[model samples]
Target: MVDEALRAARAVQSRLRDLPSRVVIYLILAACLFPEVGYPGVWRKLTGALVGLPVAAPTASALAQAR
Candidate 1:
């Protein structure tokens, strides 16, 4: 049905959450290029943190085993 197809499309769109991140980057670039728009401090910080995400460490035994 049309309704079911519509619902499926919406669900796929929702799962594509990366779109928001890309939009934020674009907005930040625009702000930087056009100083009149002002600085995108919040967006810059958010993107920076997202890019510099923390990595998980191996457990003590796991690390020793590799050594």
Candidate 2:
């Protein structure tokens, strides 16, 4: 659904960036999932989840821009 929405929104990556649109999308969803956790808490959770993956965790400023 998020992919579809991204497409509909015409969100394209024109340049190489640290945080991909998909990652930002999931971060937004995560924020909703753990409303009480706050941004920092959500970021910690995101970093933990990404530990086993090849993706790099986004910086706090980058995440804030995504929002």
Best by lDDT: 2
User: What count of clashes does model 2 give?
Assistant: 0
Tens-digit per-residue lDDT, 1-67, candidate 1: 5335546556323444423333434544555666553343433433465655753333334322322
Root-mean-square deviation of every model: 14.7, 2.1
Residues 2-61 of candidate 2: C-alpha lDDT, one tens digit per residue: 778878899956777777787778888899999998766787888885666776666667
Clashing pairs in 2: none
Question: What's the TM-score of every candidate structure?
Answer: 0.28, 0.72
Q: In candidate 2, what residue range of length 10 has the lowest lDDT sum? A: 49-58
| Residue 22 displacement in candidate 1 (angstroms) | 0.5
What are the lDDT scores of the predictions, listed in order? 0.42, 0.78
